[model samples]
Target chain A: MMEFINFYLIPGLVLGSIYALGAIGITLTFSILRFANFAHGETMLLGVYITYSLVQFSGVHPLIALPFGALLTVIVVLGIDRAFYKPFRNSPTIMVVIASFGMMLMVRSMVQFIWGVQLKGMTQGIQRPMIFFDSLRISPKHITIIGAAIVLMLAVHYLLSRTKIGKAMRAMSDSPELAKLTGIDTEKVVRMTWIVGGALATAAGVFLAIDTHIDTNMGFKMLLPMFAAAILGGIGRPFGAVAGGLVIGIVEEISSYPWIGVEPLLNPGYKAGVAFAIMIGMLLWRPSGLFKGKVF
Target chain B: MSNSELQTVLELDQIIGGYGDTQILHGVSMRVDPGEIVVIIGPNGAGKSTAMKAVFGLLNLSGGKVRLNGEDITNMPPDQVVHHGVCYVPQTSNIFPSLTVEENLEMGAFVRTDDFRPRLQELYDIFPPLAEKRRQAAGTLSGGQRQMVAMAKAMMLEPQILLLDEPTAGLSPKYRGEIFAIVKTVNATGTPILMVEQNAKQALKIANRGYVLVDGKNKFEGSGHDLLEDAEVAEMFLGGGAPP
Candidate 1:
């Protein structure tokens, strides 16, 4: 029993951390842009591709590739905002959502055409496990994923609370028109939000690639679970996303076990189904999410 | 007012403007000299706010020009108007709700590259209640406090002129007095002020000059006391529920 607990629970915790990080980016983008970005998954995939290239050609350590991946994603997101999002600044919300879909399809096709549809593992090669207790081990990949999530979350907290631009972003999120009259440069703050959100999603994608295999459609596959975490946590609540991710991750992993089911034929592959189930439950009970404040 | 001593801070000359396709201000002309308090009062839909918005570059002026000190800024955007030393405090939804009072003030000085700590201190000193609640979120404050923050934030740039659109709208009678008192204090400190208010009777009491607007035209213009005491002006625009 203890062996099972250590193996599944600990692994779920690590996976949850990555989902939380990705959801934070999604929620942040949603708040600032006032629309759901269906294209965020592609942005994450772009990060993974960048990290993969670094590891393939330069022989950079997978851990070192994390920050590089974040930086690259920031550039990509900012460029996309300048080219795509800024043009529709005053357009309707439905128009922007459609534009985001267009962006998603464009990025997805680009990734498939460039990288091809194949699962690629880390080139640097992951090491064996580092033991934590008797019959319990913690891998370096898990440590990196968990550690980076903590550090990045803390960094984001500090930036929002301490920095001037960060405060401006929060103010804009609360009330955009008011932010403008108060002399907050709405344009600059919007740019910074996209940059920061893209960076975090990129970091999460790289971490995810290290833990599993990298593929062009990996972000697309993670979308349902990522959104489930965001909505379940509360649409624009950051800390709620973190907490929701862990809950979803643990529930998905635990329910996938055949022993828990009435019908023993059910496989662990049903984990995806579990995310939808949890999401439906959340929607039925609380439409505004678990922590109700502001969704848009 | 002396010709040389009358330092014009903001000049809107025969300006014609509206939202789109509809003209609200038909040849509206107004001015504010340095250290003077000018008030524009009228019934609802008299184009008073529209005229102020044209000066702030918020509306598309179809004709005439807006100038600061002597330079033409007829077609400039609202954001650029701030750089030209024109600060406008809108009637509603003016301060960021979720931000702290201090943070909102910081954003008010967004265009400033130099340190604004001294300016912030000065503002806090000017608004002592805000000083005690500097860290509190602006949304959490009372309606009066929010108005105070909005006014103080606009004042952060220390612009040569301040434009206010119905600063005392929807406030309690007590808050109306408080807002007027603050406006007087703000104007006494060298910045010229041009305000539109629904509270005409009270507004003219503090105003140096008053303009009575009716149906997008300047119906009456004179010293505040003269307009206040004019029975014809009072019967026409003040409170009879009919246009004379």
Candidate 2:
């Protein structure tokens, strides 16, 4: 049982960390911009591709490429804002959601066109699993992904609590017009939000690529889980996203095991089905998710 | 308040504005002169707040012009209006609730490139309680203190004319007096104030000029004392009282 737990549950947790990171970005963007960005998954994919290209061409270490990838994602998302989102900002929320869906399609096709439909394995050679006790084990790749996530989450917490920009973001989330009246440059705050959100999502994408092979479809697959985690945690609660991700990870993994002899009777293809079942159950039980983040 | 010394500071001439198809302010005209206090008092739906919104460019002015010191400012965005030496404090959530008192003030001077220490100290001297609670979150402050922060923030630009939308709403009588007293001090510094207030008597008492609005139009306009003494205004507007 312990060995099985080490092999699956631990890896699920590592994957959950990535999902949490992505979900935090999603929730932040949703709160500030007031829309679910379906295109966010592409931001993560772009991060992996950019880092992969950097490692291939620039001879930069994958570890060093993390920040570079995040920065690139920030620039791209900011560019998207300049090109698209900011223009239709005053339009209805549904319109913005449609636009983001359009953005998602555009970004996905662009990635496919450029990178081709191929899986590219990471060449950084940080994949050796480190044994922890008898049954628990961790790898350098997992350590990097988990460590980076902790650092970024802490940094985000401090930034939101201690910095002027963070306060402005929260204020805007609470009441945008009031924030403007108080002299917060709403544009600057929005830009800062995009930067932080894009950076985190990009980092998660690169970390996931480190754990698994890189492909354009990778982010697409994780998109549902990330969204589920974010919604389960609450729409705008940052800390809730992290916790929601872990809970989702554990639930998905534990449920995929043999359910009273059913797993022995059925093939392992039921794992993804079980994950979605848990997600649906969560949605039915709590519509606002656990934290019930901001309404406006 | 004679017209000779009262140089025109703000003017909204035949202004029409609203949110989308619903017209809120219908040809509302008003003015404020430098170093003067102009109060607009009326019933709940009298468009007093809408008039303030028109001046601050919060609403689309469907018709007419808004001018500040002779420059046409009709339909200018709020940020630009702030740059034109006019600051507007909204009625509710006027201050950034999540920010510290000092940070809220800092945002007030966001457009300023110069060092704002003198202005900060000036506001500190103006509101001593705020000075003590500089590090406190604006949300954590009492309603009156939040109103103070909002007013102090607008004053950071040292605006030539300030527009306040119901500064005394939802405050205790004691806090209302404190807010009105602060308004007097703010005006004493030579910034003309045009306020739409629910407390008609109290507002008119402090006003050099008063406009009693009824059904989106000015019903009466005169010196504060004149309005206070008018039988119609006394009964209908003030609900019968000497000026507070």
Candidate 3:
């Protein structure tokens, strides 16, 4: 049990926190914009690279450098939205979806060109885990990631529930035509969606980087699981996305947990398959998902 | 009455519009004077709702003018139209399904920078059922209650004029009568109402004046009482029966 907690459960939760953050952006964009934003993973990658450069230059902790990275990422995302996605706002959703796919390639190439496809570490040396109760182990960085994720999640909850603009955002998501009739500025709501999505994507990328090394493909690799998380939680529900993320994360880790014997139950090599299976199963059975989100 | 008091609050002049080259409203014109309930009663495809959309700028107008307080607001988008003190409750999908009733009202006052709590309270007082279910999702309400939520949402802005497109379209007889009473109560508060109603008799009973539209043109325009008593209107529109 101690080995499972230390080796599988703790790592799964750390990964889940990162996925939950990234999935929030995916779910928001899918809901409000009414499009599958294929370029979202690239946005996360861009934030990670920016954070990497900031840490290298200022010698600050990744957490300290995260806000700057997120801000810069937001600027870049807003620019991309204006240049590529804005023209397709009134066009068919497919047009914007294809545009996002093109953007994914363009952004990935740009990151490779600037960062040279090299693996970079956000922190210099690895610190050992802090043992609690002589058997369980928890890393200080993991604690920080989980704590920060909780704070951000609470902030998002407050924004969506309490603030005027947040309420307008929810209103727009619920019914865009009624929202327009009610005098809510659609463009302003769209802009706010991007800002929130971009910031959360940056936080997700930074958290992942703190856990593992950053590479050009890191965001792309995590993209599938994050999408699975979003779909599992429900297309537009932020809280559902968090729950889906945690479930996917824990399941992926536990799938290889040697539950039957000591031979590694599913041979950790195929862990990514778990998310895909769950996602496909959800799409087949419950397209509205656990939170009863929008079907489309 | 003084000249300013008699001024029209909302005027639709020679409005011609429709979706994608199929013209619906052909030179439709209507007006709502201050402190009046104006109903436009017409058969299907007579462009009654289209005229309302024209006033709200929900469609493209090839020719016409919408004036609010004598200011030309022709072809203004729906969001901008709300700022000009004209609120419209659509026939269907008027309330955000997922938003709570109070949140729907909040979005109604999205343009206002000042406090709207008093107006909200006033609306709650007018629509008592909505006040009890203020926190419930608007979609979960019955058809009649949803219509109440829709009207209350439009009233949140306290507009100079209110346009309701078939407010009681799908309600039962009991709820429909209740809605008519609610309309009269709302009108008593001095907000001029321009409504398109299928229940022509009940609507005209509450309306100060009414218009009879046929094929997108005004067939008749008179005081509600006069129109109700008109022999031809009674034969064609009032179900071929004597005036009740």
Candidate 4:
């Protein structure tokens, strides 16, 4: 049982937490802005690179530099919104989506130009998991990932439920024209959406880099799982994304788990296919996801 | 309620504007003085709604101007127009469907820095149905209830002049009378109104003055009684043949 917990459940929980963070951003951007942001993966990768650069220059631990990188990512995301997305606010949603695809390529190339194609790491030494019981162990990095995710999620919930800007955001997301008629500055709402989404993306990136490794392709690889999580949670529901991400993460991780008693059920290489299957299955059963979230 | 000292709260001086590349209003002009109700009545497709949109700054005037208390507000973005003490309630989608009735009310006060609790209480007292459904989503409300929410939301700003584009567009006779009563009560509180309506008879009954717009130009302008009483105006607009 300890071995099972350590091997499958714990790792799945950590991976799930990262995807939860990313899916929250995707769900938020999708809910308010009404488009599938194809560049979301690239945004996360950009945050990781930003973290790597910040740690080198500021001489701080990766965790300490995480927020600084996230803050910088906010600036980058806001700039992207203003330059690429805002102009298409009145245009068809598909237009903005195509623009985001362009943004994906542009941001990917910029990351390559700055950080190069080499795989980057914040620490050189291998960190060992501290053993608890017989064959049961947990890593400090995983603890940090789990802890940070809970903190951010709570903060997000508070913001959405308690604050004035939060209510304004909900109002805008509900009916943009009515929000305008009520004199809520819509441009400001758009900016706030990006800020929230960008911050969450940064958190996901930092945690993922801490857990595994960082590269330009890490975000791209995580994209399928993150999107599956968002869709599974219901595309517009932030909390739903959380549940969706965890389920998808566990399912994906377990799909690759080597059988302890019998032959392997599936190849480990087919891990991504697990996310796809869940997404497709959910789409068929409940297109609105577990939350019945708004598609428009 | 118009005192001799009443100043025009809002005015459209021969405003000419429309949505992108399509001209709707052709030199439309009107005004709402302090504490008075001015109603615009016309046939469908006569630019009655367009005139309201032009005055509300939703349309960019290619020619002419819109003035609020003598401050030129031509072509201002609709969001900023509220700052000029003017609030507009569109004909459709006036309420945020997903927002609670109370949240909709709070949104109405988005521009105000002062506390809005007193104003909210006053509105709730006037529209008791809203107070009952304060926490309910506006989308789930009945048509009449939703209209009340919309009007109440717009009134939260305490606007000096309201541009209402058909407050009674779709409602039962009972709800229609209820809405008109509320409109009259709101206007009696020193907030003047400029409303466009399809129910000409009921609207002109309470209107201090009325304008008949035909093809986006002022065809007839008079007191509500005069417009309602005019044989020629009645024949042309009220679906009657020329008087003998």
The whole-model lDDT of each prediction reads 0.83, 0.84, 0.91, 0.87
What's the best-to-worst order under DockQ? 3, 4, 1, 2
lDDT top scorer: 3
Q: In model 1, how large is the Cα lDDT of residue A181?
A: 56
TM-score of chain B of each: 0.95, 0.95, 0.96, 0.94
- Tens-place lDDT per residue, model 4, B1-244, is 3323237778788888778998888898888888889999998889999898887677788999888888889988887888877899999999988779998899899989999999999999989999999999899999889988988999999997888899998899999999899899889877898999998888988999999999888999989988888887888786674333
Model 2: which residue pairs collide?
Answer: none
Per residue, candidate 1 scores C-alpha lDDT tens digits across A82-101 of: 99999998898888889999
Q: How well is candidate 4 docked (DockQ)?
A: 0.65
The reply for model 3, stretches above 4 Å from the true place, is: B1-6
Candidate 4 per-residue lDDT, tens place, A61-137, comes to 88899889989999999998988898899999999999999999899999999889998886667878988765779
Provide the interface RMSD of candidate 4 in angstroms, 1 decimal place. Answer: 1.1
* Clashes within 3 Å, all models in order: 0, 0, 0, 0
User: Which candidate comes out best when scored by TM-score?
Assistant: 3
Residue-level lDDT of model 3, residues A136-200, one tens digit each, is 89999999999999999999999999999888888888888888888999889999999999999
**Which has the better DockQ: candidate 1, or candidate 4?**
4
Clashing pairs in 3: none
lDDT of 2 by residue, B1-244 (tens): 4453236889888988788998888788888887899999988898999999888888898799998888899999887888888899988778877568998887788777798889999999999999999999788999999999999999999898899999999999999999999999999998999999989888888999889888878789998878888888888877775445
Across B69-99, the per-residue lDDT of candidate 3 in tens digits comes to 8999999999889999899999999998988
Relative to the true structure, candidate 3 reaches a TM of: 0.97
Models ranked on lDDT: 3, 4, 2, 1
| lDDT string, candidate 2, A1-296, tens digits | 77557766777788788889999888888888889889889888888888888888888777797798788878998999999999988999889899999998899889899888888975645556788776567777778878888998999999887776886777777677876665568899889988988888888888888787898888787788888888888877788889888777766666556557645333556655555765687677776778876543
